[model samples]
Target: MPAPSILSPRDGSNIDPRSLLSSIGEVVYSWDIHSDGLQWGPNAGDVLGRIPEAALNRGLAFAGLVEPGSGRSRYDAIVSSGGHDHGDGVVYRTRYAADLAGRKMWIEDAGRWFAGADGRPATARGVLRLERQVRDGELGAAGNDVCDRTALIERLEQTLGEHLPAERIIVVLIAAIDELTRLNDDFGHEATDEIITEVQDRLRSVMRRRDHLIRYSSNRFAILLTGCPQNQVEMAARRFSKAVGQTAIETGRGIALVSLRIGAAVAPEFSTQAGALIAGAENALAGAKAGASDTAVIARRRQGRETRADEPSLDVQAVAALNERRVRLALQPIVDAGTRQVAFQEALLRVGHGMDGPFFATAELIPLLERRGLVRLFDHRVLELATEFLAADPRLTLSINVSPRSLIDPEWLDAFLGCTRAAPGMSERLIVEVTETATIADPARMAGILKQIKDRGARIAIDDFGAGHTSLRHLRAFPIDILKLDGAFTQNLRRSTDDRFYVRTLIELARHLAVDTVAEWVDDELQATMLCDWGVTYLQGHLVGRAELPQRGDASALLHATG
Candidate 1:
């Protein structure tokens, strides 16, 4: 069925666009940039604070109440406007501080800013949504206490930082309705939506005040338990399972009992990376579903793996390695599954001379380097090495993972941009893979920086796609070219049905967005074939090839192999 036209309803009667939008729970507004006046829809008052009607109507009044340094203001949007786009106006999605009845919150504005006769932004119109409230109402999912995938990533980062490794570990639980499709087939769409909402409420009831419950998928919910011990994860999963599965949910139509399948993985011990951590939980979830009797299953214990004591002068040594040219690029081959040919080689960071030499993996000192603001040097060195390879072999298409810290570093961005600008077609041959786990201060700024790279023809891939905060919305917002499916899914794909379903879902999502997808950790022909059948565009793993050093002149230098 076609959507109702904006000009008139299906009955051919003229309809006010703002009224139509507000009737469906939207707060629409028209702002005159020069006069600082706003014409708001009826629902505007329902979303904003207890301010007087005049204050709410005046654009400056709303601006004054916006959280200071919120970064995205109407004025900023005007200043940063990309002029005019063929007279269609530029669509902008910005988050700003909103005063909501004596409380402060971020509100998301999705609208278009039009250029005036002089080509400066003159008028704007958009929909306003409470950032938190939109996570549900806009997405049409769970409510209040339930967060989205992005918030889950952020909370995980925060929780991981607050709790020391020596203290209790964090537990990530992935719970799904055993067969939600059956419910959809039994009950109608509206009824099923209510059932899922009730299921979320039931799950939230069993969770502690400090824990977080996020809607992971259509039927899956990701629960984050911070400072939870390794031994306590299973108990918590079982408790969650009983809370949802044992009780019957009263939907608008009828009562329905739901069984929750839960899989859990511990943090840092499982993996410090958010994408990897969530992937582990997902792997366990697949395992739980496969096991006939187990409603909840904790991933096999990777726990109790001791972290080596921090070397007192390792930072200094790593710096010395960087300066002395000990740091080298280890190019790993990512192969195309169908042809089994090397599609591109990923440039990995390695610090050492040769085999049996004093070797240092990039991970060991990255946290320290980032904390001390020394990662810029490492990024520069890696880029230097990768660029050298690119210059040497024009035939090579290479990928390099960059830290979020380096993304914000002016010197590094300049150097990277320079490398791409050095020669024609250089950026086209290079793929910048961003580590999803790293914290990016301003994603918009990062997007702008990426746009600079992309405008020069550089490709961008989201490394460990599932583990990070890059959602479908982000995929659109950022100039992303590839979605690298988190390795954890492929690692369990051959044996886990849930992983198979998820891999297909991700591949389909990428396809829908017209973005290519790459599946990592393809350990065998079986996995490769499965991925190929599922429409995965690229595959990378030990099954294809392992990391190797670039071929240099005989006895010229050392072979540096890295992750």
Candidate 2:
């Protein structure tokens, strides 16, 4: 069988036309146009997915290919524009449905008009191609360009209107493509694209339906959760934290573990407008990422009120006051359990505001100092004060707590050593206390740091032992001089048989290791006797001597008075 030929209109004759359509395998069809109704070529049955005789008998209805009400307007426009013009061409785009073997499919039609001898549009001919799919290579680098821009814009407007007042909505944009650039280099573009798609799906699943999530850049996403209360923003932040923790995407080339550090600011809390909200959140989020893992940090803005943990502080003046020697030092004595003698005094630092009276211990003071980055200044000053007191009373030993941050600083260590050397025979009388929780963060570094302090004739004690997850493994690894069993351990000795057994075991182990032990918060004589019988070397509480500044007499007199 031969294919039919399509010819242009010519001089008047019979305008003979033939129709041929067949569906041997794939359908095929042809059309012939004349002065009257359009004629069909041979194989028209194949194109129309029908028999050749049936296509010729009915003559194809051109309007059937177009959707209802769509092609009609374009058809009228083409007819009103003077049928067809030769030199002038008219292009008409319309969507329509086609019937093929009783099944319907969408087809797009593009028609060109031709002019006649009378200078009026005569006929129009066009090609119809099914809007199915394009080849992957033919789509170029832009791909499907599948984003629904109108849908996105409408969703954003509705979300902002319902969840946020016009004054409070903020949109923040971040560029994280640089992070993916390295991944792309290590893997490939396809692997990077997979990572991006996985991230997009995960974010969408985690976010609320009203929240507007957009892929603003190759690797960055912008999330706008509307109508979020200023105080409850952490609720949304926790969702982000959990999602980042649980969702891990695989690129086949490699696996990319998901992790995120979020920063959030409440509308009207940090800013009144959307732009500021975004900027503040980004600033806070960046800070969170720069710090430790599995953390969501909220941005704090200064606004004359007292700063909460979520809010940024304005305490620069308070920190400066500490450096001006405005902070006071107090001492709390830890006594020997069996001998009922004063063993050492723990130094407490307090910062006062005019007539505000004395504040309590160093635990309260140290956190504020650390937040203000003034821990080193406060530590140095307290060490200087303790050294002076120990020099005047050579028999008294003093304990001072040091932060992990301060312990890591070479300058702070050097300054402390210098103060110890300057004090008249005060080195041997000093005990450095580091908390068990802080030491576990970097055990190797802590061991090295404690070793240096121990070599300088200062005893190292693991403060607040048995309070947390600290195990015997830590006891064996670190070179500690003393183990100050927490008050909880002693408080439970009377009622808890398990606590008694554990404390007794700890005592025996410490004794075997040649490490001294101190039982804290031994309030009554009964608890004191039991702890002493358990072989606790030192006892610290109000039942012994209360912490006080040195008075003119033997310091041991205070211990005798308390007993």
Candidate 3:
């Protein structure tokens, strides 16, 4: 066995020669698991002088000398690791503590272990390097588990490096106690440290395993929220503030009440780099201190999502097409489950036919529309068009989608009234669909808008059923006439038992509420059959019939009417 010298490798370097004989700081060893035999490199005795040779020569002796911890055993790391290595052996890295001349030292042990025929680790070769020296109470600052600045950077870097594609946004928080200097002056160092301990403990209690709280300064702590969402940043910061400084902490002098101020920054949004994130949080911290509030202020940086000037704008082209009367509604049919006859048509907005096809669909245009208040404008236009289609034919029913934001538009009521007046019974034939998640912006407003629709003879359908997790009470409040079972539920109907059960429950609930159920995306007989057997009242998808555009100039035949 041989180990290479580490010349103050503050960070692990992959190219570091760790398999050499003249290694200074590292010791290599090979161990036979069954026989408990051990062989050490030349540097082992000199580097590990504190551990007696008797303990070093045997596996059991070394295992016995290791300090107890959740991560103590290298054996567990080797054997418990997943997958086979094709005789190349599995690699593992673990850290553990042992008595070195009666003083505890941490050792980082990295090695590859071979599995025997039984597929269990049989032998291993590894290098052990001194991680750090720890005296009593040296594990953390002031005997608390909060680590120094180094661990924070290391962890943040690791998290960014191994980020999952669908992982929630990462947030960094820099927190400081309000008037900490004044308290320190009054209470002295001993009492002030007690306050820090109390603060650290509170932060730790509120934090999760993935999240880390570090002692950044004498009075400041940096928290890394690994899985925090952008919208929940303020809420989390407020929770932390309450936890740390809500009640009075007792010290030797007296009961002292403290307050915390926190500043936050989101990753890849406010910043992508770890150093920049820390700096951004610190800047926000300064703002919090200047304002002297417990609430956190999130730093906002120029995002990478800004539309480039050189790129042709879709919004501009869409608007131009709308002006040129290039707009059309592609009507998808929703049919009765039993009869397989058209129940109604869900009107989808399509803009401009290009070489590629329509310039954009409603789904693509919606996000851009919502930002510019164009959704409400389109909503009004669609309502007017739906009323015309109903007026032109007596036996027509159409479903139109309305944006949640559109409900708050002052002109929405006027547009609805104009359409209803122009064609009597228009409301009776119209079914308005609202997305489940969109109502989150203002549910009370949604309830009000929904009431307006239901008060008239119009029907209301909540789209994307389970995505919003809306309660039964909410369904009643909105006076829903239909529950559109989101396509997501039925897509996995064959493979997912949970989805099938959920769909059944929803259908039953809708039945209790006297609301009709429409299953969207019924692209196959299996889905249609399953939904029909499950008592779904309506079906809408490619299997039933694909959405067809009204041909060039055949309105009467298209509406199934003639002169």
Candidate 4:
């Protein structure tokens, strides 16, 4: 319209800047030497999502946009030259205008200094546009399409595989739009798509140039931040939640207030595998949605089902009740596969104010107990109850769980050994089961503890075996009397060949190690039959039998009553 807003040629030739700009990318710009002002071509405003003149006049300079250490700062380096020729072109990266939500399309600027009429440094000119080398594989010629989840995952896996061992912490955040289902039903897919696009913009605005955003699913988005510091993971998570949930979108129908549930998992802490990390983040996101509105949660190591210390409302008084001996015991039978008779019963612990009060699930109870530093005491009490239960029944064999933390506690260990030594034939009837995923970091020390328990004539069973990275060599080292295969392997044994193969391998290894194998989570007759065929010594789960408390005057109950 106005001579196409081309920069004035220095060599008395009308070299259209658009031709040169096209070669590089969008938006050609120049700095006037005489006026010390910035100017850009016609499409600059559209490319930057800003009023080109206002953006430059407000001192929102290009160099200011350059991320720190994201190449050389053009202005600083030019200033160092004292208005002289600054040699060759310089390249740098910058984001879009600050006011634009989710419009932080990173620009790759490459410009050069040119001489004025007086042969002194006057104008600088170059082209700027979205970096074509972006590794996320999201951007194309149009720069409008959202990235697919599978491609995003592949990119992430590739990035992690290349960048791991650098000791850099990366974080993956999965965010779900709150009430997306309702939005879709009420406003139709078009309105939902608009809202999603708006959300995509907001999410894009908050991330750094290096971070990535992908439309992970119908209602969820995933952002990956590389080189994130360890301390800032929580802050980053909060930012993600706030960016999406802080405001409402103006739709054609009306104002649509969008909220988000965000889950963040930092790499090498949650897991090193890409799939595992994504799964962990999704799990945390589910937890956030299940709890409060607009919540953000960090994925932690999966300890137990719905086990987390960060629940919004924790009943501390319940813990106090537990400390005051308000607890209950239940026993689940681990049966012989062929005989269908109880070979042994695992003592399960539950907590409540009294027998009539609401009892918490073990998964929920154990985490809270561990967080409150009451696990040692709780373990001690459970051990006392289990020892008493064993002492009352000559024919009964009871397997009780001992927290690995208690093994390291000298006082607890002393009390445990003393209790076992005092009872008649108590050691033979008692089996101390240690969870395989316990904090038995020091294998030699754990071996020592296992040997000590075995020395007292009590058998040692490794609980939740094959759930973690414990090697077969390490399993061989433990003085284990039994191996309780983790329930995960038994989850879909009938359909999953992988699980079946893994289970078979574990059973074979157990046999070689001279340890009896107990398959846990055998939920149905089909799975039970398969386990028996595979030569498992014991099968335990709901299908076999639910956990039952012994009746008063019965073997376990009499001992519990006396205690």
Write candidate 2's Cα lDDT for 11-90 as tens digits: 11212111110111111112222232443323344345452344334323444333231122223223322222213233
User: Considering TM-score, where higher is better, how would the candidates rank from best to worst?
Assistant: 4, 3, 1, 2
What lDDT score goes with residue 424 in model 3? Answer: 64
* Model 1 agreement with the true structure over 307-411: per-residue lDDT tens digits: 467743667877887777777666667776576667788877767633323455333355567778888898899888777777776777888888887887788
| Clash list (residue pairs), candidate 4 | 102-201, 102-205
130 Cα displacement, candidate 4 (Å):
34
- lDDT winner, 2 or 4: 4
- Candidate 3 Cα outliers beyond 4 Å, as residue runs: 1-312, 353-357, 552-563
lDDT of 4 by residue, 1-563 (tens): 00121122232132222333333345546565345567655545455555344455433354444333222233422321222232212211112212222443444343444443223344555445553333344333213443444466787798788667787777888886775545654675457767877888898899999888876333467788899986787788778778877888988766788878787887888889888888788767756765653545888896776846775344475567666777666788888877777788888876764655455544344655666776888788888888777766777788888887788888788987899879856888889999775624889988988899898888999876653346655776888899887664564475445456556656766766778989876768988888888788998876777666666336555233322
Clashes of each: 1, 29, 1, 2
Which candidate comes out best when scored by lDDT? 3
Q: Pick the winner on lDDT between candidates 1 and 3.
A: 3
List the global CA lDDT of all models. 0.65, 0.55, 0.68, 0.64
Query: Which is superior by lDDT, 3 or 4?
Result: 3
Error of 2 at 71 (Å): 77
Instruction: Report the Cα lDDT for candidate 3.
Output: 0.68
TM-score of each: 0.45, 0.43, 0.45, 0.46
Residue-wise C-alpha lDDT for candidate 3, range 1-563, written one tens digit per residue? 11122222322222122222223345557777657777765556656775777678887677655554312255544543334534334555555666666767776565666554345566776656665676666444442454434456787777776663556578989887776545654775458778878888898899888887776434567888877888899999988999977799999877788888888988878777887887788767766765676689899875568767886676777667666667676677788888787878888776664533434634335566787767776777677667777777777788998887776776897678667766667789899898776655667787887788777788888886654336555666777889897664555465435456556656766666778999976767987887788788999866776656676333234444211
